[model samples]
Target: MTDVDLTADPLHDSPALREFFGDSYDRVARFAVMLADQGVLRGLIGPREVPRLWERHILNSAAVVPFLGEGTIVDIGSGAGLPGMVVAAMLPERSVVLVEPMERRTQWLFESAKECGIDNVTVVRGRAEEVDEVVEADVITARAVASIDKLVKWSAPLLSPSGEMVLLKGRSAGDELERGKYVLRKHGLVGSVHEAPTLEGLEATTVVRLQRQG
Candidate 1:
């Protein structure tokens, strides 16, 4: 993890990130800085990630919000609350559950949520595979957690019967979607890949949306 100087925060002047975050600008920036600082100390986030907070983390995370529906959204392995906390702040009407297995990470999430003044989030200290409450979520999301197949395997059962999943994939989104085709079918779910546009001119992000077909 690289070290970051909190005083010279990059998120402060990123017009795109501020626009992307809208009214939650202050809290969101604070969260980004806090995560970059304490997150590296705790080994939750790479210290190098602090500089790329907007384009790499925040935008990619916030872009998926448009594809989501109103309901409970469960973020698997919500380390440092990438998309979970971001989503919670983006849409207060939608409930969010951040599932993290490590106590330290979960503590960071709770404290960050409180300090950042985000109220629509719940931190659950457990893995997605073994947690039953997660199965009741209306939607499931994750970023940099695991392969798409594994994510679907652990999270598919957690969705409400009619719920869908919107996962943030890397540049290899298409390849990953192809690779996970079997798992999606095996779970009796329908999956599709689409682009999530965050910054207009910048490259669009690949997002996979899944739902029960049966």
Candidate 2:
């Protein structure tokens, strides 16, 4: 995907995102095309998802970047590095960990980061439940990883006191939040649902934000 053309890219219309990630425009764009073409071929992305890779996948992942504060990011179930790789490509200054137990997926993540020119990413081979001992992060990111309940159980221990879990969900985000409310409260975490901050007039992604309760 080197030297890919960016004319009329769907993300071009999102000035706020573009301006925020201005320096990483090329890297992010190349990563998107690579994920759509090569990533699909490798069984990383669904074949039918190629057409929507930009808005539905890459942009959706990158949308979470704006909501993130400066700190290390741990991405669980980092299959194909959805929000992880995309975020790593855009924000190279931040430490991004892509955690997955599958060797195939972790291998792809390492190679993909190299191909995408992302230097701030580290690929760790482990499940979300097993990495807490050595992995502490300020923000935990997930996309289509697991149910809300399981996500919290696996991710909570890895979060620092001020850490937040930023998860990407579909239209059922509100429902998931409601269903997970008991677990959130049980774990002393507060949950809120918000429209993924993205370009105007576009179908926004849903975000579930969780913070440690006082």
Candidate 3:
């Protein structure tokens, strides 16, 4: 499959989007389009469902930028780097580690990072639960990864004492949070959910932030 044609007009010269993304706008947009064209996303979500590349994918991913602090970011189950690689493109100051067990997806993440000239991202090929290492990060992000309960257990050790876990969930975020309450308490992490802006009829996106207690 071929990469998306990023030189297309609308995205190439949109002042508003350019301002929002800064110098990294074009590269991030290009990466989104490339994923669509290359069929990488199609394998998981299918072609027709691919939302508007610039507004829905890139912008939605970039929206998380403001919440991230300077440090390492570990993206759990980064299937094609939705917000992970997208964040890396926009925030060069932060390091992004994409932890995906699937070999194919990990390969794609690595290739996409190289293609986008994003040096701060590293793709690790392993499941989140099995890989036990003491890599404390300032932030941990997961998009459509799993239930909040499972995620907490999986990501608890990866976070530093002050690190925050930002999980992306759909409308059922509240339900997930409730389901994960037991695990959250057991792990000594306080959890809260925030609403993200709507995109492509996606009414509510949830950002679940968790911090470790003393």
Q: Rank the models by lDDT, top first.
A: 2, 1, 3
What is the C-alpha lDDT profile of model 2 across 20-94, one tens digit per residue?
568987788767766765776788877677655677777789888877786999999999888998899888889
Candidate 2 ranges beyond 4 A from true positions: 1-20
Model 1 stretches with alpha carbons more than 4 Å out: 1-11, 133-135
Candidate 2 lDDT score relative to the true structure? 0.82
What's each prediction's clash count? 1, 0, 0
Best-matching candidate per TM-score: 1
Best by lDDT: 2
- Per-residue lDDT of model 3, residues 1-214, tens digit only: 3433434424444677777677887677667666767743437445553544555566666666666766789888888687889989988877888889999888888888888788899888887776658456789888877888888888888877788888777767888888888898888888777776633444445577777776
In model 1, what lDDT does residue 20 have? Answer: 70
Q: Is candidate 2 or candidate 3 better by TM-score?
A: 2
Residue pairs that clash (backbone atoms under 3 angstroms), model 3: none
Descending-TM-score candidate ranking: 1, 2, 3
* Candidate 1 residue lDDT tens string, 1-214: 2225544544445687667778877777667767776877888767776666677787778889988887888899998798998888888777789999999889999999998888989888898978975347888899999988999988887888788899998778778878889998888888788888886776788898887896
lDDT of each: 0.81, 0.82, 0.74
Q: Once model 1 is optimally superposed onto the true structure by TM-score, how far is the C-alpha of residue 140 displaced, in angstroms?
A: 0.4
Model 1 steric clash total: 1
Clashing pairs in 1: 135-158
